[model samples]
Target: MTAWGVVRTAFGDHDVPSTLMGVTVLGYDGQLVEIEATAAVLDS
Candidate 1:
């Protein structure tokens, strides 16, 4: 969780999955886990 703390998109920058740390993700490709905030993105 670096690079200015989670704020990258537009097909660039994003890594942390590390084999899906915790659980309850619903959808995810790869490299971007770092748990704590599931519940559908903290209730949106």
Candidate 2:
């Protein structure tokens, strides 16, 4: 799944991109894992 959001901070609100994924054999134990990742873009 994919999503979009925003982050609130003292500087300002920033755009955040996120994603949810399922993975197989992600670790040495070979277990099923669900991962969520998010990143914010800050103004320079």
Every model's TM-score: 0.15, 0.26
Q: Give candidate 2 regions above 4 Å deviation.
A: 1-31
Model 1 C-alpha lDDT per residue in residues 1-44, reported as the tens digit of each score = 75434444422553434333446664757746444554223353
Candidate 2 per-residue C-alpha lDDT over 1-44 given as tens digits, one digit per residue, 9 for 90 to 100: 22222223432553334344555445667566555666566698
Candidate 2 Cα lDDT to native = 0.46
lDDT values for all models: 0.45, 0.46
Best by TM-score: 2
Off by over 4 Å in 1: 1-26, 35-44
| lDDT value, candidate 1, whole model | 0.45
Worst 10 residues of 1 by lDDT: 10-19
Pairs clashing within candidate 1? 16-31, 16-32, 16-33, 17-31, 17-32, 17-33
TM-score of 2: 0.26
